[model samples]
Target chain A: MVRMTSFIAGLSLLAVLLATGTPVQAQQYPPVGGRQFPLNQMSPPGTAAQWAINAGRVAPNYLQPVRVTLPQDGKVTFYESLERPVELAAPAQAALLVGRMYRLKVTGMEDFPGVEFFPSIELIDRLHPPQGREEDFPIDFEFTTEEFEWAANGRLITKVIYLEQPDRVPTELLERTPRITTIEPSRNVLAEADDLGRPMAIVRLGGRTPDPHRPEPSFFGPGGPIRLPAKVTQASAQQRPDAVNSR
Target chain B: MKYYFLALGTVVVVCVGCAMDGNQHLNKGEYHAPPAAMMGRPGPMVDGPGPGVLPMMGGMGGPGMGAPMGPGGMPFGAPPQRPAAPSTTQIRFVGPDGMQIGWLIPNGYAENQLVAPARYNFFQGGTYRLKINNIPGRDSLTLYPTLQVYPGHPNTEAYLTHNSVPLQLTEEDIEQVESNNFVTKVIYLPDARYQELAIANVETLVSTRLDPGVDPIQEADKRGTIMAVLRMGNMDLEMPGQTGKPMAGTEQGGIDQVAYSVDGAQNQFMPPLPIGPAGQGTPGIPGAMMVAGSGMPGAPISGVNMAAWGMPITGTPIGLNGPPHLPLGGPATLQSHTVRNRSKNEIPAGVKDMLIDVKHDPGYRLPPPVSYIQYTEKHPVYSPGELSMPAWAQGQQGQGQYCPPQQQQ
Candidate 1:
């Protein structure tokens, strides 16, 4: 009787083993796509959604606040439209649209006399500061003297600005000046920045200037709308700028 | 007891069946041979003439002698070590001021010119013999060196395009060369992790500076990507002949020829001919060509055969020189050639009958795509008297708009 009971127990154990293995075998058949990007291990750029926005599939952020800080006193001009050119002093504050590329002209640099630089800013993503305090936490676009010298020497300077992820970085007081890390040309700067934090914008400075005689309309791009802070607008009004700022 | 044993055996068999079912989808096909070119070993044509044919040849030693014959009784060695495509790499010659740099052409050496901190564009994946003369201190001494520009690799492409390879002959290198010692210098771009400084710069590895038996080429390769290699020796390549002239292009003298020129008008650069019996043409030999296959009918065998009367065999030759000693056997004579494919079939039979039923589990869930976002906040109402608006803000809304209405959505 005992032997017969053991046989029954063995058959029951086999049944349990067979039942447990079926689900695992079934799950192995199909493979799921990974959530993270394989090359950079970062989320895809927001610019990728431009096509969807154009097709009326998604909404875009308009007038994202961006602050341009030059090394020395300089004039920053933004072509709001072919007919409208808004000029402001250095440390200029403007709200640009996300997923859009804008061309800005810098002149009257105290250090670099008589030299003009046409730099481009591509906002891939936006910041989410507390409501009504967007002006305080504007995306910083700092230009150094070294970068200007490199641009003047015909070398293209590409800088990627990213917001620091508090958890990933060491806990310390943030430096007053923006941290600049120059890497090899062959390295993917976007990927490197993404590894450290969330990438927000890409700034490219080159020695190319616009031809006055036969100006290329594409050089100015599709003049996007820009918004100046109340203080900046008041200061510009005091100076009596060339282009009138409209609401 | 027998009943209990029977039940246990049945359970064991069922458990084995369940385990096998887990691995049933795995592919268990026969391994197939890869392509001949992918094997990485040299092919038959690369072995050149067998060992005894050219005993005195420098690089043609070892494997050329007694290496096992491949199919069709042909000797095979390692695969051709040539780069994929021809690319021009700018090489900057730095240091040793007043040094004259010249390179060997097809027939003789090109004119030497003073080069210090000068740059020249040279085609990569080639080994050129250079004539170094008029050294600053050692004015009477001359050196014949070989510069081998390695094929550009993906790792070094960016560095080569933006920066030139700096080739500086140091004082130690000159001293070693003057003492009748051979020196090899390898220029390489060190990898990021191997670099000690923040800036990326090219590093050089000299054979004389390294420990004995340590190859500079291998060391450089381990550190980074090699751009070019310069090997120098004290051999005099332009010795005088019995006729009181330079031995180049003379019978029973030097074998150098002017195969290429810096100025294209003199002689267009051609890829060096392959070494061995399978090569199309021999270098330094006036009009000598090597044919590997039997000649086709009606085609001349090295310009020796002619079409017969009423039976013309008209077709392109199989090899460059056609058949060796050819004559018309007959117009209708049968010629046979066989081509065998050595590749194997990796796929197993009855694979079409296998069923693949892959589907996502119903329990798995993914977050829905973002469709809408709304921001609602209260703004302070400003009285016209309290807040002064600028002219631009009054004319517009104080906001510059460039995008279309649809994009604003």
Candidate 2:
């Protein structure tokens, strides 16, 4: 019994030494301010290609849950709406393409269904026509089957990303770009129209009742400044030489 | 000057208040900060009011701390003593969620990577915080140094330092930092030796290199003077693959000419040059006309840039989708006016897709061919000779939307 206790104690001591001896990899670099990696979760499952992309092998990890890049942080929003479900079924079960560096979340769901997506690093290829913009390389995901039902009522499709995002370009092989993103509202509730003429997803619609508690709720109102009060302040003040003039 | 000092003094107090109390969460993704009371607990009366007044606790603007107020609302305190705002020095960690966050960065952590979102399920209700700050000190101190991080896969928890120079970390080391370059951490250890990786911003650098003799612009100018580059805003030339120098004495003056720079860090799709320099006066190639700049191909609003492209090569099948005569996954209809230069005389220069060298593609071992996108009166932007778009439905195409129909010879 005493020998057993001694062995156990020795093993415990060794374990503690190992734990304390080596500092965490995060220790090598400084802690990030305000930003946190959603590194805590096991990534969702998919094909070998998807796993390769998420595993930081073929590409950087793009399919972690709950990481947000904000508009204030050089982010842009590519939006589209579907009256129904959104389906990102690519050819040969390939990955769908999106346009933006986004931190996708289900902020507030209004009768929405499940969101299935594959954060394929393959889509992040720069050789494609629209290369540099991280925004233009949105990873494709699958949507719930009932997405078609929601298409009739104008579902919200929004992807907040970098302003310098790319557009719907060719498959990195040749030239030309489509102005509008295709949408099958039936497949994707927030999917935009496939006509290619409609670029931005439905951020707002005419005469839609908005949330009363929103700060500066004017999305497409007159002068269309999201923050009207800030606009008024700027308008009232004399423009300084260094004052920014953004729409 | 007087007002400035007063403002400075006021700022000092506020900055001190923020620095010392440790109440507000540090912007760097560190452990959640402790509560004010927890951070500054008042002890028993064994020492009779304790050391006359703790320096951090007695300062005005301190977090919920009680300081003796004086006449005119002055705290009558010594100049507020505050720890320096986190130096622009940084350490970065990419979390399991792929969110990049750090405590020290040129821009604070908020500007660098995404934060982990709140989770409602499987809440552990607990997380631990570790603070280790033994950095491998460099020869000189410079802020905002680029860190080439090497986050061990799966384990994801190892901090190390190796490059003697802060700017010499390998591309693989810096790969972890590509997405989240802003977040960093501040750690103070008993030992003074620091060993965390240092990364310098690619944009913050302007390393001198011999300009390659064969300028793409100069070559293209044979056809047309360099106009503008069609810089793609989406892609970037990250030189993470270029590491380790060739053997010494391999080039003139010991400079390795064989080295390749994953150049053009920004401006992805936009062309890199006009025809040649505008003075070269080389006419654009046939079928490649300088296009007018519009905006994102699909958006109604138009934006303009100086990237010059001949008429776009449109109406080709991008991928396989439907049968011949029908475009499957191709752009429904596009206008190519987004090209910066629109003058009919200006044949904007562009790289012909078939010939341009893949700068970073490791597999293809062939020298890049010099081909330009030319503007010809015939077959303007669209209308390819054969329906050769890769994945879409193949079919005879009418003239591209941006391309005007040509008159019959």
Candidate 3:
């Protein structure tokens, strides 16, 4: 009788296990059109969507979904994959003018799975002179698309579009400041950066950029202030951070 | 008792089914979301065209629809799609008898990863050669077909050569091209994490005073011009051992150089570029820059000169006879090492004041003061394979230098 009872109890346990199925949660979102990205593990679909929105590639004003082809130099990479750097297309490069905004359609992404493509817009106004490192700009917002379609070749095509915005460039970006020049007596300056971030003036004293491997010139060392050109007074200049701010 | 046995059997059967389901999930390995959660089109029109408004993709050049065509049309929103970006395709150069000669990744593909089937990103509609495998000694000489990916080529497949022609390169030509005439692609990451690591590595390599060897992965030639430096996947970090298996072969530690195989087909139609020393021209023997140690005047190694001889030039050595071999004075290396180091260090009080002084001072044209100096050594007079000197003439190669007796003190 005990054995019968044990068997009955085991049967009940088996029924419960089968009813619950596996412990793994079922996938919440089924892939569009029943096809998932081949290398989906590397880049989540939602992340790609966000990149599209931020880049202004997917926007509301998009009349129709226009596919923006990645140019020869443009790079498409996955999240956290820092080793990859891609170039921009000439047309894409041109569209990045300051005060001008654009909306692009995300397409052809289905072909390259596990890769996320982000367009890097120059932070400085396109019309302004290029700044080496200080041209501070932020990336566009991330977005998602409403449509999904497959090309004739069975590649999934993204149908997201970014909206365009009015040009809101700062006046300072368009207005150029006159270069400055200052001359003083005690310590002379060779070059300087004006308050407006332009090169104020450069006094070429015939000194080459300082080399650190060799011993410091007798006048300048770890002991004191750097040697300045003689017969010069209080000078104000900005040097490209050759030592600390550059690679 | 009979009921107990039956129950246990039933439980075992259910457990087995559950295990199978678990295995299925693992095998699929893809994260999926339901269709309802996706970003569907917005309800109200926010800007430009209204929501669900589809413009004519056809012939009409409507005002807001088609926009302009030539150059500046469609400044924003729904610009015409250009050709797709070309992608890197994994290819194995198969010999006539089907032997695996070498693996080829496009110029920008991640090279450090172990050989696997992957589609790398490249420029669309660009033409390039599939040569220049990065093996230490065995540079495949057999010519492969030049690949020109079509503008709309699908990125889903690997690049395969349907037709290939072999060229008869004189051993000297091979030597020249291998040393100097090849193209270089740099791997760069804009992320701060990578930047920190790169800065740290550069600092450690520079400040340690213990002459660290060139980075095995990303190498910057003495010109400060960087070629490919692949550091991405674990597969790239750990190369398969000599037996052609990871960690299983006799040769286990140290660097595992890539292998190359040259078999059939060389494209004779396309002329090789002139990459040898300038003035010497194409196919000409490169002018060798020989440095004799103070003690060992005659014995010098051919290609090993780059790492061994230490001159104060600011770039890494690019081997003998390689292109970009800066003749005694090529301009300073492109990177500013001092600036990189400065960015890593905290500003001292006096230095901060000096910066303010410069910013305020008008005539400071020479830029900021550099903290240190970097120098690249000269190349050897002869190419490695082209070296005709006697064995004793070969100087010691690699990181350790062949210092002159006088300089040794």
lDDT: worst 10-residue window of model 3 chain B: B157-166
DockQ for each numbered candidate: 0.05, 0.01, 0.04
| TM-score per model over all chains | 0.41, 0.15, 0.22
Show where candidate 1 strays beyond 4 Å: A1-178, A182-190, A197-247, B1-86, B112-114, B242-409
Candidate topping DockQ: 1
In candidate 3, what are the lDDT values of residues A44-94, reduced to their tens digit?
122232223344544412211111234222332111112211122211211
Q: Write the per-residue lDDT of candidate 1 for residues B210-298, one digit (tens) a residue.
A: 99999998899778778888999887766654343333666665654445445322443322221112112225533422222254233
Candidate 2 regions off by >4 Å? A1-102, A106-108, A112-123, A126-142, A145-247, B1-409
Ranking by TM-score: 1, 3, 2
Question: Which parts of model 3 have CA positions greater than 4 angstroms off?
Answer: A11-247, B1-409
Compared with the true structure, what per-residue lDDT tens digits does model 3 show for residues B240-317? 453443343355454534343223233112212211211111144333333333433333554454445565444434
Per-residue lDDT of A1-247 in model 1, one digit per residue for the tens?
A: 8677586867767685665555542221112132212121111122222322343432343457898999889998876545666777888888875655567889999889998887777676788775566877899999999888876654556678999888876655575567899976445566677777877787777655553323444445444456778787767665655444433
Model 1 Cα shift for residue A166 (angstroms):
11
Q: In angstroms, how far off is B258's CA in candidate 3?
A: 32
Q: Which ranking of candidates, highest lDDT first?
A: 1, 3, 2
lDDT score at residue A235, model 1, on the 0-100 scale: 70
